[model samples]
Target: MIRPQWEWALDDVEGRRLSTPVTPVFTAQYDAEQWLGEHWRELAAAGAAQASLLHDGKQAAPGVELRFP
Candidate 1:
């Protein structure tokens, strides 16, 4: 059976809370990172200075988990 999968969230640098967006649940880390790599600039423009790939209350993406100021 497939696992519950993973999830990704964007956070405001100064706010440090989940972005107002409906964070998506990712099935794999690669997909999450790929999205962040592409959309991070947009998020940053919208007041989100950090993107997080999380699951089970911990970081799901290796090397880069949370990006904050």
Candidate 2:
């Protein structure tokens, strides 16, 4: 089995931590009340609900209304 290694001090290595442009071709938001039930485990395990929903799931509920921006 092959495995990947990450040496923070290595200069010869090409890390996957590089930044890239994110042209959002598709933008949408999920209904939390709907998704929460299905993704309860995921939501609970998420480090940050806002960050997780926006980045991971592309959902953000700022107020009573959800935004896809």
Candidate 3:
């Protein structure tokens, strides 16, 4: 099996690692990034310490992960 281009990951409040993964809601990187910027607060308030929009289930660079509170 292969990973999707865009996927959502959730970490515990103040955690550094992703604790869970849900179905990807976006197919494009741009859309995924936009979605995170738009709905980050809601996700955080709902119990996400840090939310990430994974690109092909990987990070582009070290310390360059797209994480939001």
Candidate 4:
């Protein structure tokens, strides 16, 4: 059985996909979420406006806004 690849699809302010310097892939959903939680601030600074969880290239959850105060 092929394991599901969990990742985050980042988008910019204009809704265009972002090709960030770090493309992290996880083996589980929880890991993906944890990583995003820790790095969202950096992503926001890098011009990511939002992020969506993806499982095997399909959207797994609604987008999370990457707002920096």
TM accuracy, model 1: 0.66
The stretch of ten residues in a row with the least summed lDDT in candidate 2 is 4-13
Question: What's the TM-score of every candidate structure?
Answer: 0.66, 0.22, 0.59, 0.93
TM-score of 2: 0.22
Candidate 1 per-residue C-alpha lDDT over 1-69 given as tens digits, one digit per residue, 9 for 90 to 100: 766556666666564766466556777767767877776656666666566678755866542334435
lDDT of the candidates, in the order given: 0.63, 0.27, 0.60, 0.91
The residue ranges of model 2 lying beyond 4 angstroms of the native Cα positions read 1-31, 48-69
lDDT of 2 by residue, 1-69 (tens): 532221111011122221221212222243434443454344224321222234343334331211223
Judged by whole-model lDDT over C-alpha atoms, candidate 1 comes out at 0.63
How far residue 48's Cα lies from its native spot in candidate 1, in Å, is 0.6
Q: Ten-residue segment with the worst summed lDDT in candidate 4?
A: 16-25
Which residue pairs does candidate 2 place in steric collision? none
Better of 1 and 2 by TM-score: 1
Per-residue CA lDDT of model 3 for 9-68, tens digit only, reads 777556656544343466777787777677766666666666655777675323323345
How do all the candidates rank in terms of TM-score, highest first?
A: 4, 1, 3, 2
Candidate 4's residue-wise lDDT over 1-59, tens digit each? 89989999999999999887455999999999999999999999899999999999999
After aligning candidate 1 to the native by TM-score, how far in Å is the CA of 20 from where it should be? 1.3
Question: Candidate 3: deviation at residue 7, Å?
Answer: 1.8
Best by lDDT: 4
lDDT sort, best first: 4, 1, 3, 2
Note each model's CA RMSD in angstroms.
3.7, 15.6, 4.3, 1.0
